[model samples]
Target: MANLESFIRSAEHGSFSEAGRRMSLTPAAVSRNVAMLERNLGVRLFHRSTRRLTLTEAGEAFRVGIAEKLDGIQAAIAEVATGGGEPAGTLKVSLPPSLGLTYILPLLPGLLARHPGIRPEWHFESRPVDLVAEGYDAAIGGGFELSPGVVARALAPAHIIAVASPGYMAGRVRPADPAGLRSLEGVVMRAPRTGRIRRWTMRDAAGQEMPVLLPESVVVNDPVAMREAALLGLGAAMLAVPDALPALESGQLIRLVPRWYADAGAISLYYASRTLVPRKTRVFVDWVTDAFGKQKLAERFAGSLM
Candidate 1:
């Protein structure tokens, strides 16, 4: 079973180390398992290379045939072994640092109190994770190009609004329109993907899209740092609601243009996709969805500047 599982994980991740980490084994152990499987089958499953593992034709076909059935079999074994189907395992997840800290991180206490059986392994990341290839149980972020065998559940609207510290806006004329923002100092975000300044058009109730650029006063790649810069009265920043919500509520920050915002997309929880969703992952998904509802997050953090 270890040998076969190792083969499948190696095929998926194309790396012995990643598979080993996910399975709680050493890379050498995983390699040995794969070797044993190949010997037993009398065929080479992967073309070994220094950088990555590539599945051969027979390996690909074998993987396709056994993937679904193996999932079912493993799930069944786990269910029987655990007794009463209680979710008790390492729940690996990837989370965006700022947004995860602001919103999702708060729910940990309740989750731990409720399900002490479940152990969480959360990684704070800014890059898009390959869920299957990296063996993550889940990932929560925005603008993910969905990998196959994965799915998304929307948590809240990913809306960005112009915001500034009250001190920063004190001596300045508040912009009546999005175009008026150009004269103000700007704290801008650098895109991690392109390493360029990120820009977006603001949309009004009249459905007009207007391009607006703020004069740069501060620059950063992190949303948390962007929020900090705005709070420190450096300049106005186009901030996503989740990172801006607390400061806005606390009077440290105020929304700049009450009728306009950028519709970035939804902040979604990317789930672990398989034949059957694991019990731990399912409970986690439900817990977050329910908490977001209770807090009326979509309403409080709603993109509409009004």
Candidate 2:
């Protein structure tokens, strides 16, 4: 078990030293343990180099099988140890910063109050994370590629719309349709995974798709920054309705092309799969799902443009 644990941790971090820190052992000890495991298994698990470490094909197969079984075993042990007590543990979760701040963060206080035993550690970034490999308990965001042994529960559909400050749009003729947007100064977002600026395409109330070409006045990488740019009247931006809702409600921003919005996929809660999911994770999933339902976020997130 010690050898297997060491091997798994090393594989997850891709560094003996980092895995050692996690396991509270020295790097030398971790290396020796993995070495013993490799000998016992009669296969080389990793190709070790001074600059980097990579798993062999056999190692990848072993990791897949071992990781699942290990998670199950740990969950079973945790269930028995708790004796069905209140969920308690450090819950590590990841979320996109803009959505987390606008919608989810507000509910944290109440969540903690209800689950006094649970402590939350949240990482807010737009980049996708490997839940099991990085040791995240769960993540909330859109467009995450579903990895093996993980599952997602949809929180709300993500709808995006064109928006700008009323000040910016005041003198400009309101776009009567998608084609009219090409004349406006646009605040575009650069894709994080790909450096290219994102192209705009929206669906009308009648369900016809139209692509709008905006002349770029500003290009940003973060959603919150993009919203701020639009509010500053830098230019018009395509923003998720939920991210722009508060500003729109406060009259800081206005929705343009009232009948068009782009479908950006759903915001979902993702977690590892196990026969016995840890109590802490289950409670969080339930709590967030209920919060979204209670707030009617689904309808709001769908956008009012329709």
* TM-score of every candidate: 0.79, 0.80
Model 1, position 66: C-alpha lDDT score: 84
What is the Å distance of residue 193 in model 2 from its true position? 0.7
Best by lDDT: 2
| lDDT (Cα, tens digit) per residue for candidate 1, span 1-306 | 678778877987899998887667799999999999999999999999899999999899899888657655554444543574677667888999888888888899999899887878999988889876675778888898897668999988898999999999998999998899998999999988899999979998889888878887799998888999999999999999888888888999999997999999998889757666777788889998999899898787777734
lDDT of each: 0.85, 0.86
Which residue segments of model 1 deviate by more than 4 Å? 1-84
Candidate 2's error at 31, in angstroms? 18
Q: Provide the RMSD of all predictions against the true structure, rounded to 1 decimal.
A: 4.6, 5.2
Candidate 2 local accuracy as lDDT?
0.86
Candidate 2 TM-score to native: 0.80
Question: Which residue pairs in model 1 clash with each other?
Answer: none
CA lDDT, candidate 2, residue 28 = 94
